[model samples]
Target: MSITPQSPASPAPYGAWASPISAALVAAGATPLSSLALGPDGDLYWLAGRASEAGRQTLQRRHGARTDEVTPLPLNVRTRVHEYGGGAYAVHGDTVYFSHFADNRLYCRGGDAEAAPFTAPGRQRFADFVVDAARQRLIAVREQHPDDPASHAQPANALCAVGLPGSAAAGAETVLASGHDFYSSPRLSPDGRMLAWLTWDHPRMPWQGTELWLAAVLEGGTLGTPLCIAGGPQESICQPEWAPDGRLYFVSDRSGFWNLYRHRDAGGPADAICPMEAEFGSPHWTFGNAMYGFASAQEIVCTYIDKGVSRLARLDIAGGRLAAIATPYEEIRELRVGRGRGAGFLALLGGSPTIPLELARIDLSSGELEVLAHSIADTPDLGYLSVPQSISYPSASGRTAHAFFYPPANQDMQAPEDSKPPVIVISHGGPTSMTVNTLKLATQFWTSRGFGVLDVNYGGSTGFGRAYRDALQGQWAIVDVEDCIAGAQYLVQHGMADGERLIIRGGSAGGLTTLCALTFHDVFKLGASYYGVSDLKGLDQDSHKFESHYNEYLIAPAPHADALYQARSPINHTDRLARPMIFFQGLDDKVVPPQQSESMVQALKRRGVPVAYVALEGEGHGFRKAENIIRTLEAELYFYQRMFGLPTAGAHAAVEIHNL
Candidate 1:
């Protein structure tokens, strides 16, 4: 590699600065975290995403001083129960049970035994598992799609019991409960007599409304007369768990914040243990998401997201007191307590600004934390990292919006004096999802190279509460776009960013927001959409079962959806879109199909607007392959350079912008 002398460090524009962070570095640095579990003893398990492995999720185990991969090659431990699936595996004693993504079948393996299929495969998919030792079966949520070739394929979902190998119930599926539109968290009581779960109907997302049900587990591994314990069409209930003493507990947002509530054994009313203005749970976008676990019968170790930051606490179940547990983390995604009568350790997966997503094992007696695995093996050099600053700004309709601002932070060189930084406003996908202050290399890649990034949580993001998340209800493009614009204006008004050089980018739901902001407004000069939604009606037709009717709440209801579909869809308003844009799409994406990006690109081409389209073959909703990530970042940077008329020296990473 040729080295350039720093003696000639001169003045440069905000987006045109040269830095050490490169597209290849950012692509190889990111590793997604998921599905944390606690094994016997001090062992911990988690799923680490390998972009180099073609975006496969691998099961990693940390036992004592040794950490190893539990799921080998030719086998990916993942599920497609709801398309956006999670909770793909469960472990009992030393044996591990997992659902394979390839064949959609349940497989079993352990120390001495070889990996083999345990459950018969068909059109059935399983996830969100609970290993019932007493019943010698695996309890899981199964989705059964019709086998007809030319069918609409509206599948049926149910809670099922798959027998373990070498057991009486082995390879047999006995349906315990059925007829719920969606099901999650099939928890068994400590005594193994009762079962509890969360269920929600269509048109109403889980956050909008859901019900917590409990039923008696009969002799033949079947449920009897499920009773609706809490929640309704108005309340949202999540994370149904049973403590050691047979006390049923759950998280509900009926009081505006998701807090802890427990069911009384005497058939009386369930009481709130510790009521606070904090969110004890998050949106169930994927299955098997957990935030709290019982440390013991008398205590519970939990993580709560308060104002976009996460905190860990121990709740005294009987004393009605909550005590904070200090840690180096600000975001906790999953937590699980040690099994059996001896509650020795607490296993959790969490992250912070300086820390990558890691699996930590906490000692219950001494309050000691040990990191078992790292999401990314090594952290970036401290000199090239961009620390995030949380800022709350005013938006339309007298509302407030949240964002994480990372100004250009290159330690090697500085921009010219009094030169305002060019800001790239980022919208998080999920539109329902909140952008946390995590140390993501992708964010640092821009910031370390002298581009300021504004990651907006907006109004309808989680980590605030139910009310804040529902802010996008019926507003969709309006609320999200306004919040983003408000954040950019706030920066410009504060003299922190260049008003004329503003940019916006996002993927999935955030992509829709980015598209709308450029099409309807002129606040941003350039934009990028990663598999973004361009047509509202097309989304309603192409969405999966979990989010099929999601547009009803996001935009409008059936009869009126047609009008909003025309007025709100960016594909229909392309005539107003004159700004330069770049489109990145995954051809295998089923949630938001490539047609959304393809149609928008065609419209831009017809109008003779400057545009570039990059499509990846095997990628999905979000990019995970290393090469694809590198291509996307390089192409985006190249597009922006061409749009802003910035100069690039040496062998340039080139992208051809049509009609430029």
Candidate 2:
């Protein structure tokens, strides 16, 4: 629910307007919710972040009308596989298996008993589990890290089966499939006679290319000779699952768009199921990413992204006909069908422009939605929220880029007559990922303070067709930076923002874009980087095994990468950066280490350019602690107010702006 929209009552300077949407509220209210799953007994389960517990992740379950925490305090249900872990836990019947983040070991819990470690404490981490009831094991993707922390060798990833109690290999992991640089989605057949999984080698991210393999589960529990069913070095395949009738189904990008396809183990050509110019699959950044799931033998419940927005539909597997399921959500993160009496229900994590990310159960028969968990408990007034407008603007070479434009929205206040609001251009990370118009309190934090924002989808972002996604191939900084610049220019040209006060900010990969725009262009007068990349060589050298070779596709192969790295790195061109900027970095971030931010701060300081740096201890990659989030937001707002010469309305701890 929201307050009715109302006209402004008084005038206020942009970036200085006071609002009830404070930084503290944004941190406390924006609780992270993800990893939606359905239990065998019609129960709903999902992972929720406990910000107060130093950003610990806890598993929560809802049976009937009662909701309770499954993993209590001090027990963080998370995995470190690939550094950006997902699919950390899975449930079957009354049993649950999950990876304990602290020790990187697998734990099991059954019925009402306390969780206990099943796997020996070692350097191995497990994720993406599928229970093999017939075999008494759980098939999962295992990453074996080197015992010596100083070792330069990368962790070995493979498809391994962990034996449950009373099995021959009980309390041990037996390798089922190996020899691949990375592996995920270890799905077993309904009858447990066959297995299917995805694998990709170095220099190719899962989105760039992946191979789907199928093999017979031999009598001795070892996999027989495996055969490649689909995908290649040029084609990307995702989420391979066995249908109820034993036919294998998966998503492939051979059509320039990720679409559904089915293959029979009986040896026949794969058939495209409902081919369309939409994305039925996403980049396999983490494990267990399911865009579609089996609802019945003939019916499939799925979600696809078309032009940066998500749509829910029921696909007839036999006829290849898709029937749209009407829902308020503009973005659906994950979807899964229930079992037994709850088979008619679909569990998902979805959100819209008005709704925060939440765990929901939707009934196919009645189209009724039941809210299971909310990312945010309290909602802000409608007048304080800024609704985004999906927009596309012209960029270099007659090409177009997409973005979501948010205007300054405050019912109690408006800019003085005829004054345009200052705009913050945002570049999302993943360079491979796309941004949706979900109700994010972080974005609203700026809008409620009279600051307009432009969230750029940029070139190479997903949700668009493969062509648009491939636009940044080998043009990472150039293409992504251009789109952000063009978006800000478009906003200014349309009178939606003040050109003189343009700002750009992004984290991780987007941080590189922000730095590039501030270094190479004169459009943005101010900028912010949250754990941004300042040097490509530094990123490639320090990045984990998952993204170590990502630059080869984003920039070039190793033979040519050195030259491009030297030429395009923002740290190499800081002399051209004369604008005021602020940086936030996590000291423990192995993805984008603190050195990236420190070097840039020193460079700007020596040149007498206004700069501020905030290094957070006990944090990594992205900020998770509530205190750090609140501090960074307040510091950034203060930095912008001071740099833009706006009057500070509320009490904000002053940030030391070097050379200000």
Off by over 4 Å in 2: 1-8, 166-168, 649-651
RMSD (Å) of each candidate, 1 decimal: 2.2, 1.5
Return the TM-score for each candidate structure: 0.97, 0.98
- Give the per-residue lDDT of model 1 (tens digit) for 1-660: 112334445577777777666777766667777898877776778888888888888888888789888888878889987788899999888889999888999999988677899888699999999988988999999999899835867889999999999897788998888888998889998888999998999888988899999999998778899999998988999998988778899999999989899987677768998988999998888899889888878999899998999999889998889899988999898898885645477888888887777888887778889887767665766666778899999999999999999998766667889889889999999877888887887888788667899999998999998889989999999999999999999999999999999999999999999999999999999999999999999998888888899998998899988998899999999999999999999999989999999999999999999999999999988898999998889888888877887765224567778998
Q: What local lDDT does model 1 show for residue 100?
A: 88
lDDT of each: 0.87, 0.90
**Model 1 C-alpha RMSD to native:** 2.2
lDDT of 2 at 32: 91
Q: Which lDDT tens digits does candidate 2 get at residues 1-660?
A: 444445556788988887778788888887798887788667888899977788999999899899989999778999989999999999988778898889988888888999988889888999999999888999999999999979878999999999986678777889999999999998898888989999999989999899999999999889999999898999999989887788889999999999999996577779999999999999987777889988888988999999899999999998999999998899999998864554488888999988999988888778899988889877888878899999998999788999999998888886788888999999999989988999999999999899999999999999887889899999999999999999999988888999999999999999999999999999999999999999999999899999999999999998899999998999999889999999999999999989989999999999999999999999998999999989999999998998899986446657889997
- Model 1: how far residue 7 lies from native, Å: 8.3
Clashes of each: 0, 0
The 10-residue segment of model 2 with minimum total lDDT is: 1-10
